[model samples]
Target: MRTPPPRVLTVAGSDSGGGAGIQADLKTMLALGTHGMSVVTAVTAQNSLGVQGAWPLPAEAVRAQFRSVVDDIGVDAVKTGMLASAELVETVAALLDEVTAPVVVDPVGISKHGDALLAASARDAVRTKLLPAATVATPNLDEVAWLTGVQVASETGLRRAADAILSYGPRWALIKGGHLEGDAVDLLTDGSEEHWLRAPRHDNRHTHGTGCTLASAIAAGLAKGCSVPEAVRAAKTYVTGAIAAGFALGAGIGPVDHGWASPCRQPKVSPSGV
Candidate 1:
């Protein structure tokens, strides 16, 4: 008999540019050896430039998609991003209540091109409804400020931000501090112990999908049977490599190379060790 692949699902928006959101999530999952599935909550006319327009799907449609996937195919882990509205957030949260897998929540508030994806009205829904259901909540610096009113200027400030996010009831909080100067550092905590993740800054402009990609990668790790901290550590390493191997495609910021493994951009080694 053939072995089954680890299954992972991404609940997010569709990016026309295919560099972020659902596109990036799926790419990351495939590269990390998992079967990727999606339930798109919104569609956006986006590119490396910016978001031109957006249309959010109805709550019924969102709920139906979640049921279709969860009831049959059965996900091992689920990652959510870009819900766009409070109604959609609540709907997803309620649907998640029925899912048995671990949940990775990337509170996608703004895009790499500086377009707002989640609305100001929906912040409360994300905080009260969606976040509490998360196995781990991944939020970048801007989103940290948006959700908790705390600014992470230095590495030490990540604790305060993590505490505020933990108050929402997620088992773990992964606060991404890539926006800070010098090294790209992230903080992971469970309201008690703290894990400070530090990596050398790649100085790459093609980091368009870092948040979504990292969350999805972590979900993929969980689906493959890794613990939360182990998954996070692996994801951080993977994303750093992706960023280091990133390429410029469009006129604006491109995306981190999800296919950082298996000789996509880098040269492949032969059996002869050449």
Candidate 2:
């Protein structure tokens, strides 16, 4: 018999555009040589233009799906994104209590097109319940601004945001500063040692799915036995290459290429030399 690949599960929304949310999380897991599974929390009618409609899965339904997967196939790591409501967030948080694997939480607040995906009421549940269960919390600039009052203007400000988010109880925090100008720098800290990750900002506008991809990649690494810092470092390298290989597909913003494993698979050599 053949050995099975590492198992990574995503609890998130579905994007019809296949760029972000559960779609991107599964793609990233597969690209990184993991067995990807999903417990979809919402179904979104979205394209490159933006989210047109969204319907969250009922709390019972979400719990049932989670129980079904985790009870049998078993998960090595879990990644969460786009829990649309407070009820759903709490439901997932409760279900996760039974899981013994590491978790990566991507507190998805909005879309690349500026459409709100998470409700305001869900923020508190995420902070109080979901975050404490996370091995790492990955938040973008806007998400950091939403979860914590801190507005990150530069790399220096990321530390402040990380500090605020760390108080929420995640073992580690990764503050993505892609929204800032110049180099795309991110800060990862365990409330002690801080690792500053800096990569040249690609001029690509097709960077949809970046947040989900990075978080899921980290979860996959953790599932395969990488340390928190090691997992984050590998994930950063993966996403930087993905962003560089991003290609235009839909009418609006396209998605980062998650399958950029080897140099031969990349579309073009980005300025960052990914």
Candidate 3:
């Protein structure tokens, strides 16, 4: 009999376009050699063009899915995205506190095509409830501004952004500086220690699922037992390749290639922590 791989669970919305959200997380997990599981928090009428409609699941429904997965199969790590509303955010946050595994929270605020994935009322829930339960909280530039009122205009502002996010109580704060010019840089810190992850910017415009893909990749790494800095560095490497290999899909922006690193056996990450 074959040995089962490490299990990783994603609690996020589903993208009908098969690009971001639950779809991206599963794809990334499989590519990274982990068993992927999911608890879909919502379903979106999304395409490469944009998110047309989104309906969040009830708090009870979300709870049932999480319980079903963790109760039987068990999980080595968990990642969250696009909780949609305050009820769902609070619900998932409460659920996470009971788990023994590490949690990666991608405080998804907006879609690639400028659609809001999180409600304004839910922002408080993310900062207070959701973030406090996370092992690592991954937030992009725009998310930094809206979540903590820290407007990061250049690379120099990433530290301030990380500091603001760390105050919310996550064990580690990964401030994605992907929206900045020049290099694609990110800051990973846990108050005392820091690691600056930098990759050459890919000139690909079809990089739609960047945030979800990166956060999920980080969770996959954690499931496989990589330390916070190690997991994040490897995830950054994986996402950089994905962005570089992004292909044109529909008339609008497309998704990062979640499978792009598989062929090279490139992720080759070292196992370390939760």
Candidate 4:
């Protein structure tokens, strides 16, 4: 009866666990008042204990799924995660090049339990192909080290990390400093302007989907026409609440609460408001 909301798409693996990957991305989009779509790049046999196994889809299949949504339904923004191989990375990056939507590239390399998601061989493709096409590249401390070889020990290294990330060609870089010793701090910069986002470090361990959720939330905000800094700030607020409310799922590290921003379903405000 009314116009559809801004459409956001996640191109990532399927987490059978439902705490991360495509599941978390879609949940975050809905929580942020955006329509969610998916283009699965891989499938993981996983649970809270750990990832048991993973299998990447054919590159053509990834391409087709992306086209199926983009050609007919269209999209306002896109987020990418857990691309398993160099081929898939290049494929998704190429698809990103063809679209005008703002892209949030989460260079997802490892799982919460230390399982490798992106192949080591694929790192090069992600840096040259994927990162170059992103509107904002979101990488945690560990991811930043592997992708940029710059190990950040404290808050001071955040600016250095952002510089390394921006050299990859993203319009903006969000260097997630969650692993730092003190308060959870992050650095966002576009070489000229900078926004240092900090939040109290919530003492919670069930943060399995933090990367995917934050990146997707940023995408959702961008879809609603927020600027890069605006989208990232709002995403930080949402994820901070999520981490604080995280609950135990299985015998191991659990997941952040994607619906933490919404206690219960409230009446829609506007098509663009979350």
Candidate 5:
């Protein structure tokens, strides 16, 4: 029999746009040669324009889904995004503590178009509860500032930002500097070692889902047994290609092409029945 692929689980919200959140996470996992599973925490009425509405699931529902996946199929790695509320953040954090796998926490506070995805009350919960359970915390420049209060105007401030995030208790912090004015840069550090990842800025404005894609890609790499630095480097290269190949979707910004690795691979159809 063929060996099964590494399994990565994403506990996140649903993005109807198929760009960010659970959709992006699963696509990133698949593109990186991993099997993806999901435990959705919220449902959003969204498109390329922005999120029109969002409804978070009850904590019980979230817990049930997580148990259903991890208890049976099992996960080699976990990635989380868009917890929506303080309750959900704390709930997910508690569940993460029970998981032996590496966890990637993408502290999603805002949408690509500046729309708010996280609640104001949940910020403290994420900083205190969610981040502490993370193997790697990936935050964009805006998220970094929101979580750390350290505004990153240039690359020089990335270290300070990473330091602030690390102080919150994640084993490593990856501060994404894509919002900066030059080449896209990110800093990954575990308080002792640092990896500065730099990529040529693609002139594409449709780079939606970049953060989610990067985090899930890193989780997929970890599931495949890569070290933290190796997983992050591979994820950076993959997301860079996806950004370069991004295309227009609607009246607003489009999504990064998660299938950039196998651009010509055809979709598969499952067999009729077991």
Candidate 6:
């Protein structure tokens, strides 16, 4: 019999566009060589344009789905995104607390088009409950500003942002500086050790599911037994390649190509190293 791949469970909302949310999480997991599972917390009528409608599932339904997977399947890592309401955030946090696996919280607050994915009231719940259960909390600059009052104007502000996020109790905080001007920079810290991840900002405007993809990629790395920094480094490399290969999808913004790691998509080099 063949050995099974590492298991990763994503607890998030469903994106009708198949770009962000649960869709992106599973895609990232599979691309990173993990067995991905999901527990849908909400269903959104969304596309590249924007979210048309969103309906959060009941807390019981969310709990049931989590139990069904975790009790039997037993995830090696978990990634969370788009907890729409305060109740849902707390419920998921409680369930995550019971799981022994490492958890990666995306802390998704808004969509690619500036639409809110998380309820404003749930911010506190995320800080107080969800964050404590996270091994890593990945938040973009906008999310950092939303969760913490610090507005990241430059790379200097990233440390403050990471510190603020670390105060919430996650083992590590990854403050993404993609929204800033110039190269994309991200700061990962655990209130002690720090890693600054920088990548050349590809001028791709179709990076719709970057946050979800990165977080899920990190979870997949952790599930495969990588250290935190090693996992983050691998995830950054994967997401950077995905962003570079992003292509146009629907009428509006598109999604990063999750299949960028496939052999056919690999960049070809000349024998003369041209």
RMSD of 6: 2.4
Error of 6 at 150 (Å): 0.8
Q: Which stretches of candidate 6 lie over 4 Å from their true place?
A: 267-274
Candidate with best TM-score: 2
Q: In order, what lDDT does every prediction score?
A: 0.91, 0.91, 0.92, 0.91, 0.91, 0.92
> How does each model score on TM-score?
0.96, 0.97, 0.95, 0.95, 0.95, 0.96
Worst 10 residues of 4 by lDDT: 265-274
In candidate 6, position 249 carries an lDDT of: 96
lDDT of 3 by residue, 1-274 (tens): 9999999999999999999999999999998999999999999999999999999999899999999999999999999999999999999999998999999999999999999999999989999999999999999999999999999989899999999999999999999998898878899999899999888776679898899999999999999899999999999888887887787899999898887756564322311100
Off by over 4 Å in 2: 262-264, 270-274
Best by lDDT: 6
Model 2, range 1-274, lDDT digits (tens) per residue? Answer: 9999999999999999999999999899998989999999999999988999999999988988998899999999999998999999999999889999999999998999999898998889999999999989999988988988889888789899999999999999999998898888899999899898889888889999999999999999999999999999999989998999898987999999988875568558653575
Q: Considering only N, C-alpha and C atoms within 3 Å, which residue pairs clash in candidate 2? A: none
What TM-score does candidate 3 reach? 0.95
Query: Could you give candidate 1's per-residue lDDT for residues 114-202 as a string of tens digits?
Result: 89999899999999999999999999989989999998888879899999999998999999999898788899999888888888877
Which lDDT tens digits does candidate 6 get at residues 1-274?
9999999999999999999999999999989899999999999999999999999999999999999999998999999999999999999999998989999999999999988989999999999999999999999999998998889899999999999999999999999999899888899999999999988888678888989999999999999999999999999988888888887898999998898868887523211112
- Judged by lDDT relative to the true structure, which candidate is superior, 1 or 3? 3
Candidates 1 and 6 compared by lDDT, better number: 6
